[model samples]
Target: MTATRTSSLRIAVAQLNPVVGDIAGNLAKARAARKEAAGQGADLVLFTELFIAGYPPEDLILKPAFVKACEEAVDALVADTADGGPAIAIGTPLKRSSGLHNGLVVADAGERLAERFKIDLPNYGEFDEKRVFQAGPEIQGPVGVRGVRIGFPICEDIWGDLGICETLAESGAEILLVPNGSPYYRGKVDIRQQVVVRQVVESGLPILYANQLGGQDELVFDGASFALQADRSLAFQAPQFEEGLFLTVWERNGEEWRCVEAPVGAIPQAEEADYSACMLGLRDYVDKNGFRDVVLGLSGGIDSAICAALAVDALGADRVRTLMMPYRYTSKDSLRDAEDCARALGIRHDTVAIAEPVEGFTEALSRLFAGTETGVTEENLQSRARGTILMAVSNKFGSMVVTTGNKSEMSVGYATLYGDMNGGFNPIKDLYKMQVYALSRWRNAHLPKGALGPLGEVIPRNIIDKAPSAELRPDQTDQDSLPPYPVLDDILECLVEGEMGVDEIVARGHDRELVHRIEHLLYIAEYKRRQAAPGVKITRKNFGRDRRYPITNRFRDRS
Candidate 1:
């Protein structure tokens, strides 16, 4: 019989972080994962979608040399299987006579068993696979690996209406193994489980889902890989926002297979998941880019304080630093608070007086200003001076600047570009002002599993209690210029995430005039958000690829 039967089979899930464009490094990671699986005596090791090419290769997939390099890496791995240890099921970009395809290859020993392409090329939001990849065949059969026939679907294949999973089941595939590069947003784990459960119920087969782990630019792939039985029961679940290697043992029960041995645990909460995504995103951005350390302005405000804490948690305290660029308007409370927060986190804190720089700029511009009254122009000079100082520090010490603006501020142009907005990355860029405060409280109450920072209140109580301020002028608070953060965040969410009209937002008990004004601000601030540093996306709609708006867009809801 051509079909194989097995009472038991073992498979390993390789949940790892891969840097885009790092072909050789990714190959090494694959090799190490395969070795680990072999040590565990597994039948096959499964990697995430586009593992060799490092997922979402974007325009890099358009390059022939890059695709060829990834193909060569897969060949090398196949050669390694010549010893007949365990099979390798990996994702890579495969070039065909028709076009390039997001391909998955299954190999055992020295022989290639199967090759399948993603039937659905996701072309919306964060995915643009259709821009580079061609769809797979209408019907795909399973490959027999160690007496078990497993059907593999790349990311987005099962999520669509292609009926690929059901097709595989009809083709006699006993189970499904899905490779995904799915990124994180709030409550994404539950969504994934629901999607997989539907597929399982439809196909009458179990599924093993392996998602990529780590930060790729603005996207953070939380590795909460897991398996589900045909009965809609969770077989096992991997941790989120982490790199893990998990082995699963499956046993044939009559006509179906079930995961007999694996991990089963609860995933992290939304708050923990958001915080972890930010930390992981910042860490990968800094390390993958080869930065020695990170530095951020600690203004004694909740935004900067939380960003500083996230930095310490991501990279140890010794690698993180903070600076306070104080001017005349800078209050003594801010001074003390910045110092206190730094001490609490045990990071380097320095003071750079921006008075002189501001004075010099004022002197140079006085003649040009002539009779112009001192106003926002002068206020912005203070911010610009501090920004210059931060960049200088970054240049001299080789530290990446951490921008500390929250989404609430970014939405309404509350942040100053090239000033407080100056940084290589922002950990909380996707978080709103209210969300930032919530995470601050959450961080103080809990030390994450692998956090490098100390336990207890990393952010001082005074910092969280005090009103937020940029201190560009005397007695300044965020509320003086814009609506309350709770009000602002809600309005922005309705506009940005919910895509609600002004009348719809006003119906949410907001002042009609205020909603219109905030809507206008959100549209006008597009230019600043366009230039903002890339940050981890925890929300469904981030400022970057997730939400694209024209900087010069003119449409606004006048109602």
Candidate 2:
């Protein structure tokens, strides 16, 4: 159907967070957002993709009851539009006669205006939409809202080579309103902007990109919703790592439509964005999963110190608890640093000596290891003791344990399997060792807005400046086993994110033998990473869903 040309349109982008499988809660949020948009004199309110059912519902869409609930929720919202204050466009799963599909329902004037299914289903990286959703067969037409023709292309439809936006534009779509459930990774904002700009340039129509916010499982969507004019100019921009209902006023000048009243929100960059993404991811994961509190073992090192600070920032200091499980090799500096960090953050701190348990485990295993040397296995006992102590505290206090292994350790198997890897979540799983140190320094320098911790430095300076150590043995440092963080992180970034070959990495001023060894360690650590707890993903590739490698694979980059 062709939509009549309008002189002006005010669209509200509801970039809100929704919980997966909570249809009732999601519907309530949608209703509230619609009401707020109506109050702001918006002609239409646009929600992110799958806002009713939540983004990346994963296998939850396979359950008949869940899909029914989502449909019912959409029905309620459709019925609520009878007031005619503002039209509603929401994402949900529609069970058609053909199959189940990811769909958008456009409702206006007490009736269903149109339904558009997603044409392209992404199945790469962390997305598995094709596994559960059937792609729409053909391109859908634009929906008319207050005399404006607005195209509704779901997330992946515009990201792929489907030409959905071009087809819609050819069919008289005046403005593109794309809803996305896009997750956050480092430098994703720029990529999304470029994608929207390309679509706008191709269609010669303004595009409004709305993305979901909050964390689900390992994915965290940074809601940096924005609008782009046909001239490839960013007309409006919403803040990242926040949830809100933003409004933009558009007016047609002659034959072209432009956003007349654009509100450009501040967009964070680099480490700031990465830190906020991690904090939001951890906060949403803990809050949505109904965790009362979180506990972690602070080893007076950079990793644990920053993790403790992050937990306190994500969940208030009242909700964070720190424990120092010092062993025989634990130095006084570690104890002092841990105490200083806890005091700085104003969180509860305790000390639990692991000497008893370490000695007990050593004695118990001495008989079996009569002929073996006391080296790595013995060192792991200390970590296992600390892990057990943290779990015990968590169980006794009904708090979840937060693991504190950065991406560098996880990449090279520098962590113990059942020890440091044991936790409900890790905030820095996607960040390398150097990134961890950088974030620690950033946290100390500036207190990010919306942080629940104190304004001053929460991570002790000593923790940031001192050498990192697991304290499993006497005078041990991370560099003793693994390469320096600067070198290791560069090599890892090349191998993981850059996907560079060993020779290519060696050409970048790295030793060929060292590159090969690091490659081997990275490959061998896959099994340990597979068993590690879920963490925030701040990079283009993370260990869990972003990078998948078989444990039994024998192929190596020998070239």
Best by lDDT: 1
Given candidate 2, what's the lDDT at residue 8?
Answer: 96
| Candidate 1 lDDT for residue 210 | 97
Q: What would the TM-scores of all predictions be? A: 0.99, 0.98
Q: Candidate 1 — which residues are off by over 4 angstroms?
A: none
Write candidate 1's Cα lDDT for 263-318 as tens digits.
88678997898999999999999999999899888888899999999999999999
Best by TM-score: 1
**lDDT by candidate, in order shown:** 0.91, 0.90
